[model samples]
Target: MWHFAVFLLLIYYLINRRNSKYLLYPPGPYSLPIIGNLLSVWMGLKNHKYHHKLWQSWSKIYGNILGLRLGLINVVVVSGRDMIKEVSSREVFEGRPDGFMYTMRSFGKKLGIVFGDGRPWSNTRRVALKYLRSFGYGTRSMEVIIAEECSELVKLRASDSGQPVLVNQMFNISVINILWRVVAGRRYDLNDDRVKHLCGLVMRLFRLVDMSGGIISFMPFLRHLVPKLIGFTEMKAIHASLQTFVKETIEEHKASIDIENPRDVIDAFLIEMLSNKENAFTEEELYVVSLDMLEAGMETVANTAVFMLLYLVRDENIQRKVQKEIDDVIGIRQPSLSDRSRMVYTEAVLLETLRLSSVAAMGIPHMALEDAHLGEYLIPKGTFLLMAIHDLHNGDLWEEADTFKPERFLNEGKLVQDERLIPFGLGRRRCIGEGLAKSELFMFLTHILQKFNLRIPHGDSLPSLEPVDGLTLSANPFSVIFEQRSS
Candidate 1:
């Protein structure tokens, strides 16, 4: 038994050495025997508070295409605008990294649009986009849905009696309702307790799982050995809650089905599940996909809206400028989708918020389907590709990258379409809800500013601009007094 175990270790070492010799991988910090650069990355995260910034610091030493290994898995970190674009567009770099966390979220298999790869992902994404669009996604009808929700939100905030409201999770239900109207054909009340609990769970999950996949991805054994200590228990509890919610919602939809005329994405998926014989289109897929839509849709727009408000509150001049634009174009009337184009400064403010905040700092990791050449380096097959999205936005590509200058997005008082400003990402795997998110941001921000003057509490100091880093970037806990504007 001892001889066999030793033989197995020798063979594994041989394979690792052979793979390294064959490919001239991108340069990175020295990798110790079995652990690789895992310690360095872990420490980087500890010091930097953000994976994107950690990778950016490494890129300075190793150049744009930095390579490393986390445990036995080979990984490559890509930075710079052109390099990231190249990786994103290439078909070979379109696959997603597989791990315990990816599967844990999707009922012990890769079934959803976010992490699923190969034909399953392509098929799921296609059907999702098709049905979502059919049900008013990215259309003018979505504008009405968002507008109505904005009205409800305004009413809720107005009832606060000009008190400072902590906005970290404030927009969760409102944003979720907008997506729910399209997905499940229903919206929750802004103050729904269950919705609030679910949103809290989602945010907790965000903080627990970073882009690097955390300890579970590298050492699955740790989960069993020290489950609670490594956050496995809390993560499992969150998933269970999410699964229960999704399961109940799907079951409810199943009970009331109108095959001839589907109500929303859920009804549409149920109809598809009945007809499609493929494994990808099933009841399980429906559950996971629904959760994906809600979690992805809710988090991005809500966090971004909060970040925008935070920035505006921090800089009163920018706030006044955006408000002036709103008053000039929207007047006393509610802002419309058509007003977005005319509100150039307001649009620039939104663009700058996206650029600066970078909620999804490190985007969903992509895997190399085959040996691919990224820049001058050879990215090995099965290597997980991490794009430095936050770094790209804050890199040398922009002048005064750290500064909150909305004018960066404007040229001669017109919104300039800069390819470098890819908040929604690029290529086939880019975020599908870009239009919906944009519309929500525009409507929510404009609606709030139109009705209220956002300010810090009466005696408190200015709220910190430093973001709470997670799977996404979120503003630290801060409150805003929504003082109603005089008519």
Candidate 2:
């Protein structure tokens, strides 16, 4: 028994030594055999609220560019602006990881813009953007659609005057309506059960993805052996439901699509599909792409808006200042994209909210398509790369990073763009819906502040700014009393 134990230990040492000769992976925590650093990483991610901070802490020990092994995959996390810029600029680092989680979510293949990479992603993104622009995505006409939803939102809130309400719930439908108008050429009624169900599924899908970590992502065999233990079953059900919803919408569009004059994004995509049969333009891919737009469009902007409102409610002085700006600039009229230039303080507040919350936190992980050099480290082909955007948002790059100071984004009372603030991410994989999202956020926020004063419910104490941990950082649901502001 003693001889056998010694032999096994010798074999393990030799294997590690042999593997180390080929790849000079960056520094990371001590990993265990087979499992590597999965257990420790899982523990850190389990605390979702502090996960980004936890990654930052790890970067302190492992340096800005660090590497870890999660099961069979080599994971690299890049921090700070300079190092992140170095990694993101390389085309070799543009691939999306084909892990179990990514594959499963994208219908057993790389299908959509979010997780899909290479030719498929490029093709779909080009078509989507072109059509979206043609249909007034970033134009004044788009703001008209958003402002209509904002008006409806104000009316909805007014109907329940003096009641404590979950501000996200109020904003969710309005935000979704904006995307729906862009994507499907129609909007769902706020009370529609179909919209509510789809929203719930989208939220659940993100939560499940965040919770599982390596178990569902890297370890595929475990999912089959113990689906419930690793949340595989639940995630599959949500994905299936979401896919069905998107498919139904696509089919409905097909039946009514006018090839001559495209109505919305889906119709535009179908028109492109007719022209480019050789490309990755398929009905199934369209479903996934449309679903991606809907999910990202509604969730990120709405949550950020809610977080900004939460911060404003906590600081009445800030709220008053923002409202005063809104009142002065566009009094008693719907705020437009044209008015955004004059609303400097409001823009600053939104920028600060994005910086502090870091909604997507790490953003989506990038995969190495070839052996790459990031600074002094060698990232082997197929390795996963994650940019610590949260760290950049909270790093030494900003003064008083912990405090919620919108003034950081203001230069001499004018809103100035900062390169360091990358909430929508950067590089080839930067969010395509950024233009639409910015429009929705600006219009919705200006409209709300113009009409109402968001305050904590009469009996409740001010809620903490600490966000709920998930795929995206979201404020814990809190009731807000929307008091109609006196004219």
Model 1 scores what on Cα lDDT? 0.86
TM-score per model over all chains:
0.96, 0.93
Candidate-wise lDDT, in order: 0.86, 0.81
lDDT of 2 by residue, 319-396 (tens): 888889988998987788888889999989888988998888888888899887777778888888888988899888
Which window of 10 residues has the lowest lDDT sum in candidate 1? 14-23
Give the winner by lDDT: 1
Q: Which stretches of candidate 1 lie over 4 Å from their true place?
A: 1-11, 20-23, 278-280
RMSD of each candidate relative to the true structure: 2.0, 3.2
For residue 116, give model 2's deviation from the true position in Å: 1.3
Total backbone clashes of candidate 1, pairs 3 or more residues apart or in separate chains: 0
